[model samples]
Target: MVSSGGAAGTSATAAGAAAAAAHSYKQLKEEFVSNLSGGSVTEIAQVCAVAPVVSLLWSVLQARQSFFEPYTPLAFIVDFLLNVGALLLSVTLYSNAPLLLNLLLLTVATFIYLIPADPSIRRKKAKLPPNASSKPSPAGSSPPLGVLSTKPFLTNYRGNMLVVTCICILAVDFRLFPRRFAKVETWGTSLMDMGVGSFVYSAGIVASRPLLKEKAEGKTSPLSTRLVRSFRHSIPLLVLGVVRLLSVKGLDYAEHVTEYGVHWNFFFTLGFLPPFVALFQSALKLVPSYAALAVLLSVGYQVLLEYTELKAFILVGARDNLVSMNREGIFSFLGYLAIFLAGQDAGMFVLPRALPSRFGLSKRYTMLANMAAWTLGWWGLYFLVTNYRVGFGLSVSRRLANLPYVLWVVAFNSGLLFAFALADVVLFPGFYGATDARVEKDMYETATSKVLKAYNRNGLAVFLLANLLTGLVNMTVPTLHVGAVTTVGILGLYMVTLTGVAVGLDVYNVTIKL
Candidate 1:
């Protein structure tokens, strides 16, 4: 399901002396990220396999809330280092052989999952809640282990994706980080391109439950009320955006302005998008299908690109007006909005039935299988066939966030969500698909799960720290000149810092909301 793109690097910018003086530091690093073609879907898909594969390994090895849980620091270190450590390597050193490594790991995990283990190895260890039984299951029988539910998987996914984005944001400044993994200039994808869309898509996934609930209840708020609530939720983001803009300008930071724009950043895009969705959703909710709504928006945007001047406007070096100055960020808004809607649609399908509902194993199995089917069906048949045979053969562009890009993000995220869902089914042996959150009495939590949930719970704080640290690193170190070995070491240390802080927060029961 790989997409075809224009050249390796393409963006619109003017390299004038005034602009050059205003952005003097780390010019090489700026060029390093500019106008690069990205990795293929096949390669990205291979990289994504590690998380699901590792989750299985955790299950087969009984790392789930086992005696290892007693050794808190050691368990967290072992679990996180193995999981994120492997991820770091794939996107850096072993990127060339991601498929082979992932396949080998998957094979080992599969064997361990299927073969019976020595009783000693399989013994259960997670401490149950006070009201729940702590006694071990009878010998020779599979414990009524954790019941598979969607919440834990969703939590882990959100955290993992956030961490991945954070990793790329910092790593891209270094030479060892693959250019193919960097954000594309005009049209194409790389891991970084996927990362940005994933952020927007994830927000949609969380937003959908509430958005749809409102629809189900036939509830509508006044435009002013909607704006107030949405802006309240988005203020931190807007403040962060303003701070970033000011900081970059004040420091004369070497920024690839074309990425967002001369005056825009991701924080602004994130802040602006949710409120736009809120104001417009009253009209959009009138249509029942989010997928349909996404298609309408994407196709309409594509029409503007083809028939109007929007595409040319974004691709040109026009700084004559405010709209032209922030063209990439502004023009791409509709595309992102479509991606958000698509994510919401996916949420509608995968979100388990309401709490305390009588969802059964059959339903869970069907739900997970449906995710797999959609991922496979769209990836193998719909995405590929349409990309190759459809109108004008549009390439996936994070800059444009056009039709092809929206579809790609939706398909890509569906695959990741499916992987997380599949992990629950395989790891939590006895009960599958039961929506009762409390059904996890016998289920053991893996360090990866706990750590990731911690990050998700304190996402805004983590993101701020990452941005601050990334800036510090780029300022103090000559990142563009770092050797591969040194680059890897630096990235490793960065990951350790992030993982440790997140784990500490989790350990201390810290929940910092934006």
Candidate 2:
């Protein structure tokens, strides 16, 4: 009665898992050794396998000095490698070790990295006296414009840092976060899903801002008047009605709607971001930075372990609501907002310096760098995620947001942005060349410019559309499949549809370049 077939299948699965784990382990070791010192022969060989990519990024970084001014290709390479290494280590540590142990390790690593080695280390690296500049201002007490300018380099670097942070967040999600994050059916799932959709759409609005301007005044077209009334008025009602109908139909009869209702979508999240950003912008302007921080502190007060549990208990006490709404709605949501604001402020710093004439880097090289970073980021994410299959059980759920996962998510998000930026360059060549205040002039560069301009030239619309469609797909599709053939068939169909839409839109001049 001993079944040879059963034994073989088990052995195969185990072997596959072991092989995956070993590959990941090898990758981690090579990347770590390469980065810490000069890579060994084996490490170099592994890196060389991806050298075409690495060389491209290095060249691109050198060429795109305007966007990457004050940073060298070497810096990006180092950071990219570090990001990949961190993602791998985090996945390995989380999947194989106890949660508490890994968390402690992460805490230690972050603290050590963030904290200065010397307690009394001074940040000021300047050798010149504050007033030593030859061109003194009327207000002699004020620092010189160019010399004391934190506006260009500081803000630009921080913006780059934010990009890196976003990339890290992506890595975590793809690699480790999903394992620990609550399953799709977990508490607050519906609200969270909706919130995410709203946030994504709202964020898109921010991207769209550059595309929308008054013809006469050239000021950003104020949509707050229409959008505030429409979104605030409609979305809630829509959600409520949909939820109520599902409740009435009963679960057995309307299982799909009921389950989908629980999940939040990216479109909803992006839709809300712009108005929120606008509101926050005005609020921050009125208050001093310290005062703003104070407000943030107060709002963030309910985020502590005790307070969060108590608040959740009170809000969803008896209702079958997601329990972790407090965490999602408040803590993580605020973090996202902070990241967004940081990015916004950073744009101001980068835009001034990223003027076309100032962009001295060769375009081809810049594109190459972007491609390399994009590729490596994806590659790193791939390893981080697949490593889990081998026994390193990294989980990015609510209960266990491991540090490695955090880093991965941040990296992934940044990598996406960079890749998109590169795509934009290809589609809308010279799009960012215009420095004039006119949005029309700033929108296009090529003969196909009209088509690109017509399509959500703001870049936000594309993201919103994509997010909405993706979310809808996630909601409706039976994501689970038994075999490769079925999965491939479904994916192929989806891609075909997407391609058809793209081609149709292009023919109609509705397509954006990217």
Candidate 3:
């Protein structure tokens, strides 16, 4: 579920460099091929492999007119080298490194990069004036938590409400519709259930955009804005899907073309959030903050499942009837919406504290701290998996909304995030040191500068790319088979590559530095 950092370190020029930079992505693809073929060139391969990711992180940190902008590029190189070194050493010690170690490295590096420090390069890259008029930021901008837009609140609200309503009603229809209504096995059932639920979650964020109106006037929205942002971004894909539908036979090219399909899931849903949030700033005053939303969705849903079993008719799976399925109708969307909010909120809350304030590891002490934190986190995760011997199992998947299942996902999420935080702080030191706490000034103003600028600016694009990539992976790989453990490796690389590339391109395209 973790993704590579997006393009945000350097000015749009750097992203252009990366895009036009023939050496990066191609080299990375070769590295993947090497991994499969067992070819040598591991050292050079590793360097090329990690460089883009590091570069992207640097750009994100510098995109904001922050104190740390000067240090982003250096931070990128240092973190990149450190992560690569860590990977090499870890691999030398073992045949394959664990996921926990990788996450820890990223987390620690990111955290260390936020703190301000000394500049690495004498002549810094010239950033576009923060007030430049040539570049108009996409709706989403700023850190994930505070990310919002300046659009009318009602506009977002109405759109989101409709999407959520669609999902709820569809979910209900699938559950209770007559057999004739569902001619294709569970076609109407599964599609309506999951599709409608996800859409509603997406819609809610769109509706909530007005809450962040003050923040979204000019800046790009953060990744957390995905619940709504996804919807907005998907409009193109959705339209393309319609075109594809009308142009081609439903079963001919359409059914088989998973990779190239116009319709998708996560990205489309994530794109609408920033605009929605921008539309409704006053809304935040009335509703709970992102954290509360997460707790409300997750814990509240858990409680309802424990106590209420009114709508069990629709929740048809291995864990059916544990709690009523009816609660999931609207509440499920709420729950998912909470998680989406939480992801963005957590990123915002934690990013500033994690990275150094200036640039270039201020001192050896911070670097050591970053490394130590990562080591401890990695060790803790290793112990948990080894001691508990909890293998990945779909048993929980069948148990929709089960407490244990939910907890499991939460734990996995927290662990991964903690690890990535440590890696970011330790490796990058004070990469994105310039992010000011003054988001109330304006959303657009806040976004152009910050460690997460790329994610804010191009989150929708990145989400779209990742979703499509994920879909392609799903289409090509046998994710369900017990023997598909090897396939899991593909997800790791996919996440890292897609996120970095998407972010980089977004920054390059959206933010034109003069």
Candidate 4:
């Protein structure tokens, strides 16, 4: 009887342990969700409020008489304080507020900042010398800034910085610090998702610029030639992917596919899809309507994927090493291709054949109106699909690249571009005005401009460098054991180093074109 009693006690103990384990798992999952959602909210607020304001300040500084002009100590001090204030407002206030309230406040602030106080401000021109020539320069003489300028829209620098920043933030979020910051899941559309989408879209715009021009001039190459060129461009990416896969073992296969694990996504997509897009351009000669086609393709692809359950098929054996053919890595290429096509379409519209010599008051208002209209239209589409469409929501599944995800990316990108453009118009009146040739030349030569150009010139290199640094830092440090302050300091130092490298490369006129 005593032995029977002991066995019953043992069984009861085992049951209790199992119940405790389940509870712990549930708690962790809930915490993870909360943190990620909060982080995403804060990130959106920062991009909307902080990033544009900072860009405005930079534009104002760049508009000064010269890049090297001497300034009073007080001026420097004031600038420093302003930056600090901007940072605090971006991080603290938005983070503390309710998500709806935060978004509303940001919208109101953005609108106020975009509105011109005096209508005449738009007509103000850069004063020229009496003897200066007034002849208009030939169109297309100036070098294109490659669709990634701070003054115009979501620049490459901003995107690159975001990637690096997210890497650092993730390091902290993943138990590196004492307290957790907001964290998102591998599957969901988070701030990181937006950042990646933006970066990819920017790349697409840059790649398609030359092609768009060629189509416009009726100089598109034959299909065979385009295919060969694309394959040649893809070779390097293939090699890099192979090398990275061989070198970086024991990495989480899930993370690898989810977070750029040495796969040939960027390289292969650029190499392969452009040829197809070019072929479409050549065959149809439909430059104006390509965007509509792209939207149709994105939605259609998502529907097919849902009907077929292709995701389940790919994921079944994903954990095994299958190189590029793995479910997580290969399927995303289609969605990415759609994004690229969309970006190409956007580029055609945003980068017009001719920029006006002078943006008069009425013209400025018209531009603002157009910006607002485009933003609203895209965002409205995003809202409609996510709200009404079955199985549609703003989940940026990088793996799936679903329809809702594509809409979200396009909408936010358009909105950010409009915000930046408005900021530029308000902050640098002379830039959009009928300015002297020399002044215009000097404007492009400013320190800010030079740095941005340099960073953009070797964008792939910068991305690779950041990845290398992230790996090294993870290897050398006990990331989870570090303090929050220490993590921030390290992140700052790392960013500065990356910026310095880009600037140095620019100084030497070095561009690592692949």
Candidates in order, TM-scores: namely: 0.84, 0.39, 0.38, 0.71
Colliding pairs, model 4: 35-183, 36-183, 176-479, 176-480, 189-396
Which numbered prediction scores highest in TM-score against the true structure? 1
Candidate number that wins on lDDT, 2 or 3 = 3
- lDDT (Cα, tens digit) per residue for candidate 1, span 114-174: 6665454345323332223444455544443321233556776787787787788898888
Q: Which run of 10 residues does model 3 get worst, by summed lDDT?
A: 180-189
lDDT winner between 1 and 3, please give it: 1
Measured on C-alpha atoms, candidate 4 has an lDDT of: 0.54
RMSD of each: 9.8, 17.8, 18.7, 9.1
Query: Candidate 2, which segments miss by more than 4 Å at Cα?
Result: 1-275, 286-336, 339-343, 346-412, 415-481, 510-514
* Model 4 agreement with the true structure over 1-514: per-residue lDDT tens digits: 5698899999899999977865564445335334243234244634445555555555554343232233345543433333333333333233344344445545654555555443332232223321223334566555533322223333423533343343433344334322212324344455555656666677666766666667567776778887777777667766665655654554421123444323544445555665566566653555346567667778777777778867566544455455534554566667776777777766665554333334453444455566677779877877777654653454555556777667777777777667766865554544333233444444334323443455566777777777677766765665545675676667656655666687678778788866
In model 2, state the lDDT of residue 476: 57
Higher-scoring candidate on TM-score, 3 or 4: 4
Model-by-model lDDT, in order?
A: 0.73, 0.34, 0.35, 0.54
> After superposing candidate 3, which stretches have Cα over 4 Å from the reference?
1-249, 252-288, 317-331, 347-459, 462-514
What ordering of candidates by lDDT runs from best to worst?
1, 4, 3, 2
Worst 10 residues of 2 by lDDT: 147-156
